[model samples]
Target: MDDARQPGRAYRGRRRAQAAHTRYAAVLTTAVVGAGIVALGVSTALPEPRNDLSLEASGNFDDVSVRGGTDRAGRSRTSNPMSNMPAPDVWILPMQRYTLTSFYGERWGRLHPGVDLGAPQGTPFTAVAAGKVILCGWNGGYGNNVMIDHGDGIVTVYGHASKLLCKEGQLVKAGDRIALTGNTGHSFGAHLHFEVREHDKPIEPLAFMRKHGVDIQKHTEAIYG
Candidate 1:
């Protein structure tokens, strides 16, 4: 009787071990399936990569009235037309077309520090390079001026604007619209007073721009043909 009971108990113990093994296998299969589902969900939720250097219209330009996009000849103005041009940094002309009314030198009895670019009163002007706005407001003779401080002791000034599109402490990129040409402060006509200063002293803007691979005189039209 004792030997018979021992075999029965052994059978019962084996059954209990089999049941525990089945439960562990089910839990492991569920865990694997759940982990796979989570991985699939994460992959679907990821966003596509984008190009960082590609030019895009800024929301700041939309807040103020400015002319952009295509021109009269159906040429695209927003795209980086000058991408092929060589420069230390991205640089663009202030206007598509403008007349050089005055240059940097002696005027009357005082030193004229900037070049006067003549255009329509409401014609828009852009920044030459990426920089932060150091000054934006009425600046005595500059009148409704906007100054951008590009790094390395370089600062670009836009004066005599009819409407200022940027503010102090604002960051701007090359080709970003900053103001509209106008006769303000000591200006005599609708024009943009453009200046390039190094360490607070004015330099010859055209030559400086040319050295940086931008010929302002020849490339006054569209950035590309």
Candidate 2:
């Protein structure tokens, strides 16, 4: 009887040891799994790394060969909504016979998106050319403004007016009065602020006009003529 009890006691002790080992293994596995999940979350929260184009490389970003201007295997890139404009052929002058207070591409301590033609308050403003009115209303920071979409990826914008006479979608002729010059919207003085956009990008106004054969010097000549 004593021998049998000894064997039974030894078996019971072994069984308890096995159970403890199994419990420890389970706890270790849980801890490892939890740490792995936390590490994965931290990795996911990190921002993705991107390569910024250098200033020198920016000029070449539009090249048809290196950039997306070409297809996967050297095919020509097609521009969507391709400009249907009549080669940007139009003559534009500020509504009033005013001085050029600010020209395009000048760093005015800020991004000057257009040219400023200084006119006295209430000077009659007109359309630069014949175009359909895309916008003729008050806009944020552009009180009593007008925008003309003459098609062909070219658009003309006039801002800071005292009043808007034309309605939205009205067709305007060259030299037609569209509004009155004023220190409205965001302005330091009374001026007719104008912008010409080619596919929404603002380039030098006088140079662009010259490239289109609309002589900027003609403004002075026509005034004298």
After superposing candidate 1 on the true structure, give the runs of residues whose Cα lies further than 4 Å from its correct spot.
1-88, 220-225
* lDDT of the candidates, in the order given: 0.57, 0.51
Give lDDT tens digits, candidate 2, residues 1-225. Answer: 011111222122112212323433533443344322110000001012112421211222133123222242122122212223221123445442566887665353444667787777877777765566656766545566777655545667787888787875465555556888888766779887787767645556776666643444344212112
Model 2, runs deviating above 4 Å: 1-90, 106-108, 213-218, 221-225
| Candidate 2, pairs of clashing residues | 85-152
Q: For residues 44-85, could you state the per-residue lDDT of candidate 1 as single tens digits?
A: 010122222111111212211122212411321222232232
Q: Which pairs of residues have clashing backbones in candidate 1?
A: none
lDDT (Cα) of model 1: 0.57
- Count of clashes in candidate 1: 0
**C-alpha-based local distance difference test score of model 2:** 0.51
How many collisions between residues are there in candidate 2? Answer: 1
- Taking every candidate in turn, the Cα RMSD to the unseen true structure, in Å, is 30.8, 34.4
